[model samples]
Target: MESADETNTKLNGKSPSPVRSTRPKRSVRLTVKPKCFRCDKCKCEFSDQTNLDYHVSIHATDKPFHCETCQLLFSKRASLKAHVRTHSAAASAAKKKVFKCDNCGSKFTTSSHLKRHTRTHTGEKPFVCDVCGSKFTQNSHLKSHARKHTTDKLFACKNCPSKFSRGSDLKAHVRSHVVEKTLKCDSCDAKFSKKSHLVRHKRKHSGERPFHCDQCAAAFPENYMLKRHMRRHSGEKLFHCDICGSKFLEKLYLKRHMYTHSTEKPFHCDTCGSNFSQKIYLKSHMLVHNGEKRYQCEMCDSKFLRRQHLTIHIRKHTGERPHQCTICLSKFLTSSNLKTHLRTHTGEKPYHCDTCGSNFSENSTLKDHMRTHTGEKPFWCSICGSSFIKNSNLKSHMRKHTGEKPFHCNICASDFSQSSSLKKHMQTHLNKYQPL
Candidate 1:
């Protein structure tokens, strides 16, 4: 008879993924000190099979049990019993390190998560929805995929009429209805709702072009941007002009160009009675009417309606301002005015501000800002051309220009552009004596 210590052996075979090594393998041993039921060293206590059947099933190297969802193979029947919990939704409720991926930092308690993430690198799609020809790398993707085929919107917003396919989608959409834009950029003051959209915004600040087109040297930050840019080179005009019959790649370009063809101005200013065909033109016009840009410059304390416009305004504070004066060795404040001043030296822009008889750095800003003294808005709104000491002040008065801050300073009643300003203001108590 072999001693228990001498007979103690380690199985020498490849284990699947080595995750099983953390848990010692347990199997029914044939050797017995107690009397055997039918024969010696033969029967399993749990099963009735005593001879070849019991010996082949439990003591075998072959993995007879396997999972249908995730491609995980198991050797023992009892080990396969615990594997089924991974596919269950309830299993996701309590998360432990059930599985981890080596390629990416993402970790999940279920083996399925690691499997799904591996698909991102391999581009594998095991799950496919039958209703639509949509394929997904994971079963959970198939669930979200099926929702697109059906009119059954399970996720409905309590506050709004909006409906969505998934519960998480509805939860994100609800955040937009609030009076706040809490999503601040790490690089800048810009805020956005969706993280994907914020990522797109980040690329704008960083000037990152991740999406590349093989057809051309052109690249964009997003897939849709690349798709749109590719159309320009390919001349793939999907959006056709009704009047001229000329086609454009994008709907927005066609819409903006439609203004030349159509006399109908859809976008109208409530204050000035000015009308516009394009929605963006309407938004710009509405901004003109409202005279407001909520985004203020952190450097020199200037405000802009659009975040990009404010970004351009920010270049003013830094000496890196590209807009330079063409006259004798002079550099000026902002890009807009630099072009106008360049005209005086370069004599580039022949257009002059008539009231002051001053040649402008920019024909537009000078033209707009000049209305201050004349109190004359020749481009008066059909609604009302309100008076301001400056046209910029008139723009500031535009009722639509509301900042994120609803409250103002109690002492001066001065309005701040953002809520962060108020928070910083309140903190001034601790550092009141501190020098700048």
Candidate 2:
């Protein structure tokens, strides 16, 4: 046998020692040569050296890496690479329930979210707040909260000239600007913004209201939305008004009320000259202007600006009499509606016509009806000298008198009093009805 140093000389073509060796010797003296053995059938050595017994046909046939959970097996290197995922998934399922957070009491379907949340209680904020000396568990929470100070609003809306600090907030804000939501439900073809929004909007489509209020028995699609609604019954005014003793359940509502006290008409409708403090208020006001009622009564198919309005609209159809008129035994859906109804019985039309002796249900309604008598058209049509109750009504009513109908029909030359009416009339040709 050749010496260890002589064996190196043969492997490297250089002599380190005078002693001759054929095979190179290792200092550790490994018992195994880490090489494949020759098979008797073919008299060939295997190429793979990781497992010398891989050359054995019987041992190579059994894939020990088979996943019990996924029941996947592998024979080749490529197949084993694919099959290892099943073992990893099974291992992940095993490690899932083991490491959990004690703070938020959240269970992770994967250990990643639990790991991220654990950093909160450990005072390990991987995400640091640049604004104040605050730290958060999520980068998104830091991103959204940062908008309160800096106006680095980068998220621009595709529909409108609006920007938001956060991408999700921008997505949510864009929903209020447009009437259409392209993302439809799998169960029902209802459209909405986010998946959660789609889920909530689906309740409007299927009427599958699951969350019910304990205090007033009012139902909502989402539990969080229901929690916000429950504050109405609980009278838990969490959002306190800075100006007065008044408080609101919603922060947005309180913000809008602050505008009312300040008379700050921030948002304005481009189509109609109507102004509003809240974006939703502007959108709802456009309903009266365009005569576009997206929300329809579940019973009568009559439309309204809001779901609450539609809920009120359904009482007229269901006749599930809610409010009782204490004076005249008349049962109505709303207290204000009953109060308006009582005026007809009592002949106490507080809202009187200045030009005629006509009394009405509501003061605004009476004010509106007075215009018909007095011809005092405060809402003048630019196309014609027609005055009306609201500027939007005047615009709609002007189309009826002017014969200059801008909203033309694809099927016919039919004109309408309102743009909404023209759109609905055009739908007659396509036979396209509102989807639920």
**lDDT winner among the candidates?**
2
What's model 1's lDDT at 376? 59
- Tens digits of lDDT, candidate 1, 1-436: 8554444432434333434457768997886444333423222233344443544453343565775543345676766777767456433443465565676554555676566556665655678789766556567657876877887675566667787776678767967777456678999888864345566787778888866665458777776787688555434455655444445668877877766544455776777576676777777767755666789888877878889888776765665666555456576656546644655665443335556666544445554656576565553222355544544444444533543446477755766655567678766654776787
lDDT accuracy of residue 339 in candidate 2: 67
lDDT of 1: 0.60
Q: Least accurate stretch of 10 residues (summed lDDT) in model 2?
A: 64-73
Q: Rate the local accuracy (lDDT) of all candidates.
A: 0.60, 0.62
**TM-score: which candidate is best?**
2
Stretches of candidate 2 exceeding 4 Å from the true structure: 1-233, 238-247, 286-301, 304-306, 324-332, 335-378, 381-384, 388-436
Tell me the lDDT of model 2 at 290: 68
Instruction: Assess candidate 2 and give its lDDT.
Output: 0.62
Clash pairs for candidate 2 = 2-21
Overlapping backbone residue pairs in candidate 2 total 1
